[model samples]
Target: MLLNQLIKELITKMGDDELIIGHRNSEWTGLGPIMEEDIAFSSMAQDKIGHSWALYRILHEELGGEDPDQFAFMRSEKEFKCCHLTEMPIGSYDFSLMRHFLFDHAETVRYNSMLQSSFLPLQQLARKVRGELKYHTLHADAWIIQLCRAGEESYLKMQTALDNCFQLACGIFEAGPDDKLLADEKVYPGEEALYGQWIENIYPVLVKASLNVPERKEPVYGGRYGKHTAYLQPLLNEMGEVFRLNPEATW
Candidate 1:
């Protein structure tokens, strides 16, 4: 495929993934592990949802009147472009924290790469997104510490979540031809590089928490190429329920 087509595909897929993940995560509002984290996670979820909204708008207004919600909510499971990471069940607090750590780490890297995008809109959006995640990561790190220090059980659970989920987490970086184009064009760094950097930064945090970092494995594939986990359908079902019931109803 041509580079431009690939770029467009990459953006669209990434957008849909964020839209659903953000929406799902946001559902945890007021239901999180603690009050502060509840608020913080919801805030982060809003950031993602806001970013998704922008991506959807860009897809519709800038690209064409594409059915952003349909692509997001009503698409077939295979049609979904989200990675296995975001679609996984939100586990216990420790598990969620582990997921948060993995996710925020990759997103930080993705935003950094996107910061250099040649496309002005993409570059600007990425820069803005990067700026927002700082607090989230900080909160996650703090929680990791508190949880790890709180008890052996918390630490062990966090370790398991980290081990079980990190592979899928890494899949978030499975780049495509568009990734190549962006890297070659100096618009973005390769995902492998980003993933490596995350390991470097996050490894010590896990070590300090006495949380066992899972032996990194070959990524479990299927983010950039649009293959989602089995869990995505149910989430989308709930997400689209309201809209499906009344496609024409105003919010």
Candidate 2:
């Protein structure tokens, strides 16, 4: 692919992940196990959505893409590049927490790698996103460790959650066709490198939490190329309903 096309694909994938996961996070608004968790997830959802908007803005202003709102809210499910992990329903609190732990750490690794991107706009966004993701990973890490150490039952549940989420989480690193091009141009590190870094970054935390990382798991892929679970279309419908009802109406 052309460099410009490659960069657009890369950022669009990043932005789609943020947007979809932001909506998934928002689903916990009133459903968290505790008041504090409710607030924390809600706040994180806002941050994720804001990050998506910023990415879309870069696409619009720098790469000649569509409006942020249109890009986020009007796209069909197949048009989105978010991973299937983001598309899955937020299951039990254990599942949600584990997913958060895995996903946010992956986000941390990706953004950190982008800190020196040849794409100046992405590099600037990475600098700003890095600080916010610190607290996100911190929150996830603390909870994982705390829950795992709480009791045998809690520990078992956490371990199970980790096992269940591991493959899906691996999908988060699914490579774009142009990933090598991006890496060669120093636009960003390729997915393979980011996957390696993500493993290193999360292994210590998993050990500290007493959770075992599942071995030899096959990654679920295809989301980067628009294939998704059945869950995603319903989510897209609900998320876009209001915007579609009045696309011309001012917020």
C-alpha positional error of residue 171 in candidate 2 after TM-score superposition, expressed in Å? 0.6
Against the hidden reference, what TM-scores do the models get?
0.90, 0.98
In candidate 1, what are the lDDT values of residues 127-220, reduced to their tens digit? Answer: 7777687877787788887788887777677777777888888787777755667678765677777888888878878878887777666888
The regions of model 1 sitting more than 4 angstroms off are 65-67
Q: Model 2: what TM-score?
A: 0.98
**Models, CA RMSD each:** 2.1, 1.0
* Count of clashes, each model: 0, 0
Q: Count clashing residue pairs in model 1.
A: 0
State each model's CA lDDT, in order: 0.74, 0.92
Model 2 alpha-carbon drift over 4 Å, by segment: none
**Residues 1-251 of candidate 2: C-alpha lDDT, one tens digit per residue:** 49999889888988999988999999999999999999999999899999999999999999999989999899888899999899999889999899899999999999999899999999999999898999999999999999999999999999999988999999999987678888999998899999999999999999998677887469989999999999999999999999999898887
Best by TM-score: 2
